[model samples]
Target: MKILSDTIKNIALEIRTGKTPPTSNHEYFGEEINWYTPSDLDKGKFLGKSRRGITGKAISDKKAIVFKPNTVLIGAIGDIGKLGVTSDFSSSNQQITGIYPDPKKVDSQFLYYWLKAHKQSLLDKSKSAIVPILNNKDLGQVKILFPEYISDQLLIANLLSKAENLIAQRNDSIRLLDEFLKSTFLEVFGDPEKNPKNLPFTTLEKLCSVIVDCPHSTPVKSKEATNYPCIRTSELTNGYISWDSMQYLDEDEYKKRTQRLIPEAGDIVYGREGTYGEAIRIPKTHKFSLGQRTMLFRPDYKKTNSIFLWAMVRSEFVYRQAKKKNSGSTVGHVNVKDIKQFRIYNPPIELQTQFAQIVEKTEVLKTQYQQSLQELENLYGSLSQRAFRGELIKY
Candidate 1:
């Protein structure tokens, strides 16, 4: 596998950083232009309409730099390797670097894929491990490996793009399954917010047998793998506890943390601070303790089903309440006092169980989709490595 390499600066016709207009100036922001942040890079290879935008006044006042369509954007701050390609004329904040590929040297899509393939290598050049920062100079000097011929570059780019599209399709399938589950919930129980079925309205305190807040202090963290995992706010993502980023606690610490009550399979866990309102039913797979800024709910069997209670907590009905009740202005967090007063639309136990059964069946399908998605992602990673090394296609 033969490959030609050059620094990004030599291949790029122009390199520029994005800038943000003064936020206090109300005249600067409108829906006129895409104002991208590091977060927007997650939308895929090509940038979509940004969540926010700036007015023409911002561009005229020299408060923001507008990049032409097809410019490649890369995260330059904490999230060092995040990437996006502009789909239209756009401006971004200071945390992104825009590169205009020199047509004679490399194809735009090829450069984008090449950067994706060597993301880890770029990450390695970050100045600090604690708070990763890649300055313009380091980023400019970053090495790019590609086939010398433009035709080979296009072939490699197209191959990787097709592979990426497959991965995206699997993800879309999983998301559709999630939507179906939500629709089923609505059909069976009606909206928790409106309670169109005229179900009994009650407070969260009466709905559960016990509601326990997590230990206020951080537990002693173990560096090695252990049977005891201390679930943190970050672990609660997209309606589930992701153990991949979990912190392990020593046996003694785990026991100490669980002194109030042990977490069980059916118990529901909610993040009260940072990513508040996201809740997940504790699965039967492992014995774990809750970390700070989280709370636990044990549904009374006589009153409701665990999954039903979890579904209500995860609903937009509760999310809106959580946001309004946030006590901290800087770091949003919901208080236990406010949480206990949350109004819930309680349907009969029988109807709740029926919804739970539907959820269980839907989850099985989602698991299959997720497994397929993981395999596709792994395949893409492998193909990317080979494609960049000039082994994917026989030239």
Candidate 2:
């Protein structure tokens, strides 16, 4: 076993801390800098972008410290151990501390992943009354499995860098798919503003029929194992359905919920509740029943291409339209009637096929990208588990 111990004085670092200073004009808190909160730690390892930003003057008035892009951003409050690298120079909440390596002493990526892999442990070691926090004093004292060889750190960094590249590619593919949809809509329908088509484009009722939701509510608790799989809208992704996380209903339960939705091949299932208008095409291979939140529109295959319809659902126009017809006050929902009444521009078969081809090709590439990401995540999981366990050699 390799044993290495080192201690260094790690002082607490913070941005402006203290109650909001009241100013005579209320302009003191005007120029606030970007402050990432603990809730922003959901990106897992690396945070490329942030949601909130404060004013620049706020930093000066509050004496908030500016974080360098290379520094390790660590949360000190409730989320005591979560870690990320400040890709873009930015400030963090008062409870955040920037962990700077002693010039070339550590790889930032290595540090981020090390802390991320050991997040729970750091949490356990922290001491706090109201909220868990690892003060600056304890931050440097916390010993991690630091390699004596810098080469080992660089090697791991390279591997992780490649993994990061794969993730970036996946993100790009997703963006491109969205772009293709946007482009397809513009090509087929032309800008609804510039040239509102003179084609026989009318109410969505003309295209297909039968837009239906599942059982009005969640199924009653039952233990009976059914022959069919029941899936919810939450499970759909990018027009594909995954049965890996599906629930199995018993025969009796299925018999009782007669309205339970059965997805037919080419049936486009849409999310009517949370992610309203988000839809997935039910491939023939998808053998399952739809849950309550899922609304399946069995399009007349002869009139409308299900693939085209699924792509349309992902468009901004349909999303806004669905939101408009939503029934509930707080949590919006879409019903069958609302869906059929929704209009669609009927392009020629050639145009429909051309758009379908683009979507189809992009989907295939997306599937490959998804698989690559999953494999990379799994590999990272294994590598991290082994590395933290002292199983990884100092290569």
Candidate 3:
């Protein structure tokens, strides 16, 4: 790839802290400006939509500068190297820096992706005293390679845009499939809202082994590696958990930390709160252990199939029940007490096995669907690298 040395910076303004913001809306005292956070960005680069929005009035007296719709927003802290571009007019908090690229000298789209591709490089220099942050000086100095002329830049952007559309279509398909899976669950079990069962419900603790969430006191952080599976809420895509996005854990750390709850093959792990009610069966590869804020369920083989238990937990009725019992001022969470009382339907073991078979079948198909989508994503990535290298054949 040819190297172009020109650089870009965010609108040069003095840094302002949140409490001493340059602007503020008196109505919402705690609201930040309609700014996007680092956590809002996805690896896929399509920032679907964000629920958090701040306004000019909210940032009163703070650095209330606004970013133009065309500029790309970069994460400068905790979540390193997340890239977001505006679809509508917006501004961001101090955690994010709005990049006003020199579009005349560089393709903003290309520069955005190039920064995305080299996110780690940006992150490496994002070290700060109290928090990890990308400094303005480094961001402006970062060089981007470009084609000899604007036409080449346009050509590259068009190709990437094509791949983006394909990826987006596949994303939509995946979402559609997820809806189908929810429908399937309803088809299998009667709808929770309308069809509240008169059938007897049993306490989860009585039906199976209930492991409480890990201690939140202090967690041993995994040092990231090239390839080892780590599970967090972010990896759960749609209704199913995608293991591919996980952080790699060293064997020693994995074994040491999760030793007490190195889960069994059929164990069902539950994400206890926030985006709660997701339960994933332990695939043989990751039958390792539990993380903080996660609950592990080991079904009694004679009474239930693990898959049946998974469906049972995720059903609308269960989520409603979980929601009702949640506590906390800021974020509601399901604790061991709440989980112990979670009701389970004591249907015949035969029916449990049957449902397990169906879930397994769905999983098999889902795996294939996920693999195809993943392959397309990989292909797009490979094409991006090749296109940058000038190795991709011009069509």
RMSD of each: 2.6, 4.7, 5.5
Comparing 1 and 3 on lDDT, the stronger one: 1
Q: Lowest summed-lDDT stretch of 10 residues in model 3?
A: 11-20
Error of 3 at 265 (Å): 2.9
Reference-based TM-score of each model: 0.90, 0.76, 0.73
Tell me the lDDT of model 2 at 113: 72
Question: Can you tell me which runs of candidate 2 are displaced by over 4 Å?
Answer: 1-34, 38-70, 75-82, 87-90, 94-107, 120-143, 149-151, 192-197, 220-227, 242-246, 258-261, 386-395
Best by TM-score: 1
Error of 3 at 10 (Å): 12
Question: What is the C-alpha local distance difference test score of candidate 3?
Answer: 0.66
RMSD of 3: 5.5
lDDT of 3 by residue, 128-222 (tens): 66778677777766655666566677677778878878888877776776677677766665575555444456877777764656545333545
lDDT (Cα, 0-100) at 83 in candidate 1: 90
lDDT tens per residue, model 2, 1-395: 35344442322133222122333534433434445666676465666555656556655766446676666777787767656677766676667777766544556677677777777766766796788877776666777665555567666666666766777777777678767767876787676434566644555667666766677768653364455566687677655666566677776666555454556778777788866777777666535566778777777767778777677667677777788898977887777788777766676666667778877787787778778778877887787777655566642
- lDDT of all predictions: 0.88, 0.66, 0.66
Global local distance difference test of model 1: 0.88
Candidate 1 local lDDT, 1-395, one digit each (tens): 35778999999988999998999998999999999999999678899999899999999999999988889999988888789988899999999989999988888999898887788877877797687888878888998887888888898888888998999899899889878877888888788777788889898889999999999897999989788888888999778778788899889999999999999989988999987888888988878899989999899889999988888888888889889999887888999989999988788999999999999998898889989998998999899888877788784
Two-way lDDT contest, 1 vs 2, winner: 1
Top of the candidates by lDDT? 1
